[model samples]
Structure formats: C-alpha cells, structure tokens
Target: MVSIGEFGSKIKENISRVIVGKEKTIERVLAVLISGGHVLINDVPGVGKTMLARSLAISLGLEFNRLQCTPDLLPGDVTGISILNLKTNEFNFRKGPIFTQILLVDEINRTTPRTQSALLEAMAERQVTVDGRSFQMEKPFFVIATQNPVEFEGTFPLPEAQLDRFSISLTMGYPDEQSERKLLKGISDEHPITSLKPVSGQDELDSVLKQVKEVEIEDSVLQYIISIVNETRSHRDIQLGVSPRGSIALMETARALAGIRGRRFVIPDDVKETACDILSHRIIIKPEARLMRRTNRDVINEIVESLPIPINNEKT
Candidate 1:
C-alpha cells in the first residue's frame, strides 16, 4: 500500500503533467483539498486556472461539476429549486451542480452580483436552503471558483462578503520557459487531464482531513492570528478586516499545512505562508489607500511583520 505522502506526491505529479511550473500552486490546491476547504483561483485568462481545478478534481477522485457563470444564471440554477410533483401532489427538492463533491465555478465573475451572491449560502454552509428548507451536503464537499483578473469588460468582482468564505485565493502565473517546453513536449493529441486518475478516494480524503484537524497550534500562534486580524481592522488604509470566520480559516489552513509537512504541530511559518491568500481577498482598502498605490500584498506584509514571532518550547 502506498503511504498517504506518496499518494499526495503522485497526485501532484499527475496535475503537473498538465499544469507546468506551478509546484507551489499544486501544493496549495492539495492543502485546501486535504483541509476540506473551498478556494478561489483569480488569474488572467489562458493561465490554466480552470485547468488546475479540473486537474485537481480528477487527481483527487472527487465528483466534478462545473458551471460557467453568466448574467442569465439564477440562484436556482446553481442550487436546485423545489418543484411540485404532479403525481405526489407535493413539492420535492432536486439537487443542483453544487451537490457534487468537487465543483468548479468557471468565470464566476461573469455572472451578475445578484446571481453571485446566491452562492454565499452554499459556499459558507456547505448546504443550500430552498423554499424555506435547509439541506446538508455530504462529506468531502468543496468549491473551487475561478475568475479572470485581466478582464473587466463584463465581469462583476466578488464582494467582500462572498470572498471571505473562501479559504484561499491565488493566481496561476505564467509558466517558465523550461516548464512550458516540457508542457509542449508532453502532448499526445489528447488532454492529459482525461488520462489522470484519483490519487486518493473520498474516504482517504476524509481521513486526511481528520489528520489535518489533529495538527495542533500553540496559544501564542493563536494570539498572532488575532493580532493580524485586529491590525487589518484598525489600519488607516483599510475599510475592513478579516472576519471571525476568516480567522478560523487561517487556523484551519495552518493545521493543514503542518499536516502536509508530516507534522502534528503548527509553527508561525505555517500561519505566515497562508495569511496573504487567506486575508487579502477578505479586505477592502480605502479609495485614498488605493490611490496611494498600496496593494493587498503590501498590507499583508506590514501586518505580518508587525506581529511578534513566537518562540517554541526551547525559549522557555
């Protein structure tokens, strides 16, 4: 039997066959998968953002469903609507695309804000409410939404509320020449993604998620996370800070990172590595701050630098 670590590596290798020069992005995708958390892939077109999501779904052995967001999309479209069953003379709920274990929402920003907000409930709760009824989703559910960063022609940017629901947001930057060369050499007239197979089953995924939960963090690290959130809230250039749920995402992602490193403990590095992806999307800078040309990366760096690094047991 292959160890889980080996299995994880195989999954990464399989994905890289299709998406070149993105080892870190692959690891982030894996971390979010094992963490059982949703993700937002924000990048320019033709950068393989959607391909990454599809590759991940195939590699992880999860059921994949994709929706191309458009202005015509309705809330009932993503989350199934209730209807009257003529024979039974009663209303019955039918599941939508979001019902699957792995859902890829491609070009999510292409849809209207009203249609986009419809996902807020599903992404955050992992369930849908229809006709005044709530339904719980099965285990191993996750959403991987993609957006084109360079195009604003007809796109509606995700609101801060919906953005906070994602555990991480990332861009798939251009591949290096060597990586692109390798990618060009791998073609056999068919997409590599079709040949890809799952590295682990949903059961294995659930087990790994359990392991992620087992990873522990010290109280000092908890304080560090809080300090960062507070700083963002009080920053003169910022209009909003990460919500409590965002703090939870940071803590959860830190544990998942530690687990990926084969450890049952978390350190400050795990938190720092995840802070930007986790917090940047959740904040909104003031107009003056934006005019000052300050970026989300800058704010994240400043907050991270201001926090005192915690010493481990050796310091005590």
Candidate 2:
C-alpha cells in the first residue's frame, strides 16, 4: 500500500501543474477530504478556488461535478427530482450533481437561503431526500463550496447551521510574485489544468483514508483540544463559540495531518495547525467585536496561543 505521505505528495505535485504557491492550502484541503469532511473556501474571485477543486478531484480520480450557484437555483436543481417514466408510468428519480464524489459549489452565497439549505443534509449525512425517499451518497463524497468574501451584493450569508456543517474554512489568497510569474508563463495558449492527470486511483485513496482514522493521539492532546473549544464559549468578546462538532473536526483533521506527514501519532502541532481553519467558521462574533476589528481568526489564535501544550508526548 502507498503511504499517506507519498499519496499526498503525488497529488500535490500533480495539482501544482495547475495551482501555484499554495502547498499548505493544498495539504489542508487534502487532510479535510481524507478525514471525510467538507471544505468551505471563502475568498475573492480569480484566485483559483474552482481550479483547485477541479485539480484535487482529478488527482484523486473522483467523479467531479461543478454547480454554479445563482439566486434562482432551486432545491430540486441541487438534489434532483422525480419524473414520470413514459413507458413504465412510474416516477423515476433523476440524480443531480450532488451525487458525484467531489462537488464544487461555486459562488454558493449567491444562492437563496432555501437553496443553500438543500446542501445541509447532503453535507452532514452524505445523502439527499427526494419524494420522501432517501438516497445514499457514494463513499469518498466531499464538497468544496466557495463564496466571495468581498462581495455581498446579491449574496446571502450562510446561516450558522450551514457554517457549522463545514469541517474546514480557508481563503486561497493570491500567489506571490514568483509564483504568479510562473503561472503567467505556463498559460500562454492553453491552460495547465487541461493537461493534469490523476496521480493515484480510488483504492489507494481509500486505503490512505482508512489509515488516517487510525492515527493515534494522546489523551493529553485530546484534553487540549477540548480546552480550546471551551475558551471560545466564555470569551469576553464572542457571542457564540465552537461547538462539539468543531472539536471533532479538529481532532479528525489533526489525525489526517499526522498521517499526511508520515506520523502514526498526532502531536500538539497537528492540533494547533488545524484548529483555526476548522474552528474559525464555526464561531460567531459579536457586533461589538466586529466594530473592534476582532475577527474569528483573531479570537481563535488568541485561545490557541494562550493554552498550554501537552508536555507528555509518549503514546499510550
């Protein structure tokens, strides 16, 4: 079986053909998917959010589907509908893009709250309901939903319930000067994404994902994760805190990160590294905190830094 590190490296190298100077971001996204969690990418347009999703799906050899969300997009459009079969005279179910292994929801905030709610069940349960029937999603299902942080004009902010369903939220910032230069040179007459290929097959990915769940973490580290979540609940400037789901997400992603780094045991650094991205979106800040320019990231960072690391690293 291929090691997790090797699998991650191959996927990252293959994706590098299309995306530039975002190794850390790629690693985090890979970890989230390996941990069986969806991603919420909050960023400005033209930063390769869609391209990144496509590259990752291709690298993993997953069935990829893109849904460009609009205000008019409906629940049935995302989850499919039941239609009458002409010959059989029975209602036949037609699958939507949500049935795919990897679904990229572009400009998700532009869709109505009703349409947005359609994804909640799929993201949380990996299944969709139509005509009072439940349909199970195939294994390795993942979502990479994107929203423009700078533009709110016809966009509806994701409700707290929707936000909490995402395992990790990140921004793919603009690449550095050298990487941008390489990007420009690589895209003369043709795009690099057109030539990208799958680095590993589904079986290998499944094996690696299984191993990620088996990655070990000490009891001390687990308590540390709980402490971080607890801090958010009582923080003076915060109106809401990270939920238990956020804690689980942090631990799961940390395990995946450890596996990706070729470690059988998770350490403090793994928890610390994955905490902000996993917990930031799950938090709700007060109006006063926003006026003070204190973002969720700031509060998460303060909590993470103020907490003490587990000195006991010996695995049980």
Candidate 3:
C-alpha cells in the first residue's frame, strides 16, 4: 500500500500537467477529499476553476459530471424528477448530474435560490429525495462547485446554510507570470488535461480515507481547535460565528493534512494551515467589520494568529 503522502503527490503531479502552479490549493483539495467533504472554488472568471475540477476528477479516476447552473435551472434539474411512464402506467425516476462521483457544479451562484437549495440536502446527507423517495449517492461522492465572484453580474450569494455545507472554500488566483508564460507556451490544439491519466486507484483512495480517520490527534491539539472555534463566537467584530460543524471540519481536515504529509499524528501547523480555508466561509462577518474592510479570511487569520500553539515535540 502506498503512503498517503505518496498518493497525494501522485495526483498532484498528474494534475500539474494541466493546472499550472497553485500547489497549496491542490493539496488542500486533496485533503478535503480524503476527509470526505466538498469544496467551493470561489474566484473571478478565467482563473481555471472549472479546469481544476476537471483535472482532479480525471486524476482520481472517478465518474465525472458537470452542471452549468443558470437562472433557469430548477430543483428537479439537479436532484432529478419522477416522470410518468405511459408504457408502464407508473412513475419512473431519472437521475440527474448529482449522481456522479465527482460532480462539478459550474457557476453555481448563477442558479436560483430554490435550485441552490436542492444541493444542500445532497451535500449534507449524500442523498436526494424525490416525491417521498430518497436515493443514496454512490460511494466517494464529492462535489467541486465553482462560482464567480458574488459581486459579478447576475449572481446570487450563497446563503450561510449553503456555505456551511462546503468543508472548505478556495481561490484560484491568476497564475504567476512565469507560470503563465509556461502555460502559454504549452498550449496546443488539445488541452493538456485531455492527455492526463489516473495515477492512483480506488483501493489506494479507500485505504487512505480509512487511515485518515485513524490519524492521531493529541488532546492539546484538540483543545487548540476548540479554542479557535470558541473565540469566533464572542469576537466583537463578528455577528455570527462558526458552528460545531466548523470545528469538526477543522479537526477532520487537520487529520487529512497530517496523513497527506506522511505523518501519523496531527500538529498545530496542520490546523493553522487549513483553518482559513475551512472556517472562513463558515463564518459571517458583521457589517461593521465589512465597513472596516475586514474580510472573512482576514478575521479567520487574525483568530488563528492570536491562539497560542500547544507545547509538543511529538510531531512538529
């Protein structure tokens, strides 16, 4: 069996064939997948958010599907609908794109609130209900949703409930000049991702996911996580704080990060590294904070920075 770090590296190297730079973002995505969670890629258009999802799906050898969300998109369009079959004189159900293992919801913010709510159940419960019947999703179901900036035209901001369902939110900033030049030079009629192939198999994926649950997290580190979460609730600048789910996500993500780095135990750095990504979207900043130009990321970072690291040399 391959180590988690080796598995992570294999996928990262394979994805790099198409996705240039952004190594940290790729790693975080892998960690989230191992933790059995979804990702929200929030960025301006043309930053390769969709491409990143495609490359990841291809590299993981998972069943892939893409939904181009629009204002006309409906709940049934995402969760599927029951149809009357005249031949059988009964209702038959047709599965939608959400049935796939790796579902890339492109421009998710463009969809209506009713349509967006359709995904909440699936994301949180890994199942969909149609006409009083519930269908369980396939194993390894993961959602990689991409959205344009909420400030962009014709986009609806995802409600906090929807945002909390996502384990982590990431940004694919414009690649550096060197990386861009490399990308430009490498461009061809066929995209680089088309030639990319899976490097890891289902067995490895399952093993790593199982092992992530076993990754040791010390008491001190657990307290550290709680401290950060508790602070969020009382912070004067914030109106709403992260829920218990956020702390759970932080702990699970830290475990995955430890496994990805080839460590059997989690450290403070893992939590610190993933806190902003996992907790930023889970929080709601006050209007006063926004007026002061404090973004969610900024508030999360501030909280993380203020916390004292537990004294431990077990796995630094």
Candidate 4:
C-alpha cells in the first residue's frame, strides 16, 4: 500500500509535467483535496487555472468534466433536468456534468446568481436535486472553480454562502522567466497534459484522506485554531467573520498539510501555513475597511500574527 506522502508526491510530480514552477500551489491544492474540500482559483485569465484542474484530474485518474459558466447558464443546465421519454411514457433524469468525479467550473463568476446558487447544494452536500429528486455524486467528488479577479463586468460576485462552500481560494500567478521558457518549449510540440498518466486512483486517494484524518492534532493546536477564528469575528476591520465551518476546514487542511510533510502529527506551523487559504475567502471586510485598502488577506494575517503559537511537547 502506498503511503499518503508518497501518494501526494506522485500526484504533484505528474501534475508538474504540465504545470511548471507552481509546486507550492499544487501542494496546497492537493491538501484541500485530501481534506475533501473544493477549490476556488481566483486569478487573472491565462494563468493555467484550467490546466491545473485538468492536470489534477488526469493525475488522479478521475472522470473530469468542464462547465463554461455563462449568463445564460441555468440551474437545470448544471444539475440536469427531467425529460419526458415518449418511448417509456415516463420522465427520466439526465445527469449533468456535476455527476463526474472532478468538475471544473470555468469563469464561474460570469454566471448569474441564480445559476451560481445551483452549485451550492452540489458542492456542500455532494448531491443535486432535480424535479424533487436527489442524486448523490460519486466518491472523490471535487470542484475546481476559476474566476477573473480583476473583471467585474457581466460577473456576479459569489455570495458569502457560496464562498464559504469552497475550502480554499487560491491564485496561480504568472510563471517566472525560466518556468515560462520551459512551458513554451514543452507546449511547442504537444501539451504535456496529453501524456500525463494517473499515478494514483480513487482507492489510494481514499486511503490518503483516511491518513489525513488520523494525523494527530494536539490540544494547544486546537485552541490556537479557535483563537484565530474568534479573532476574525471580533476584528474591527471585518464586517463578517468566518463561520465554524471555516474553523473545521482550517483544521482539516492543516492535518492534510502535516500528512503531506510526512508527519503523523500537526504543528502550529501547519495551521499557520494553511490559515490564509482556508479562511481568507470566508471572511467579509467592511466597506470602510475596503476603502482603507484593508483586504481580507490582510485582516487574516493580522489575526494569525496576533495569536500566540501553540507549542507541542511531543515530538512529531
């Protein structure tokens, strides 16, 4: 049986064949996946956001589906609709792209709020309701949603409720000169993604997730997580704070991070490292603070720095 760290490393190495110079970003994405959480990639266009999602799905040997969200996209389009089958004389449900193991939602913000709300149930509950009937998604169901951060025209910002559904929100910044050169050369003939093979599958992924849950988290670390969450609620620069769900995500991602590092126990650094990605999108800053140039990331940094790091007595 492959260990969690080995499984993670194999997936990262496979993805890197296509996505260059984003090792840390890939690791964070894997961490979120191991924790059974969805990702929101918020960045400018042409940053390999779609490629990252595709690479991960290919590397994991999962069934991948892409949805190009638009203003005309409807709830039925995403969750599927019941159709009358004249031959059978009854209505039959046709599954949508959401039925797949890995779903890539491209330009998610371009869709209207009603259409955006359609994903909320599927993402949160791993199931969809169509014509008063619910359908459960297959195991290892993961969503990788991307949006352009600088564009607001014809884009409806995701509501806080929907935002909270994503475990981590990240950005894939432009690659450096060396990485870009490598990328250019690599894609000149054929895209590396085409040759990428699955290093792990659903069963191995399930094992890794089980290991992540078993990664020991000390009492102090638990309190540390709570402290940071509490600070978000009372912070003056923020109008809304992270919910208990955010705290849970922080803990789960931290454990996954520890497992990725080949450690059996979580440390303060684990929580601190995953804190920004886990909590940033879930927070809402006040209008005055936004005017003052205070971002949610800035507020989260403040909260993280203000709290004391928990010291673990046992060696990990």
Q: Model 2: residues >4 Å from true position, as ranges?
A: 313-316
Q: Tens-digit lDDT track for model 3 on 159-229?
A: 98999999999998999999999999999999898788988778889998898999999999999999999
Per-residue lDDT over 200-315 for candidate 1, one digit per residue giving the tens place of the 0 to 100 score: 67677766766677677899889888989889999988887778988998898887777676667889888998899888988888889889999887888888987888878732
**Model 1: lDDT to the true structure:** 0.83
Model 1 segments beyond 4 Å from truth? Answer: 1-7, 314-316
- Candidate 4 structure lDDT: 0.91
Task: Report backbone clashes per prediction.
Answer: 0, 0, 0, 0
Q: All predictions: root-mean-square deviation over Cα?
A: 2.1, 1.3, 1.2, 1.0
The ten-residue window of minimal lDDT in model 3 covers 147-156
Alpha-carbon local distance difference test for all models: 0.83, 0.92, 0.91, 0.91
Model 1 C-alpha RMSD vs. true structure (Å) is 2.1
- The lowest-lDDT stretch of 10 consecutive residues in candidate 4 is 185-194
Give the backbone clash total of model 2.
0
Residue pairs with colliding backbones in model 2 are none
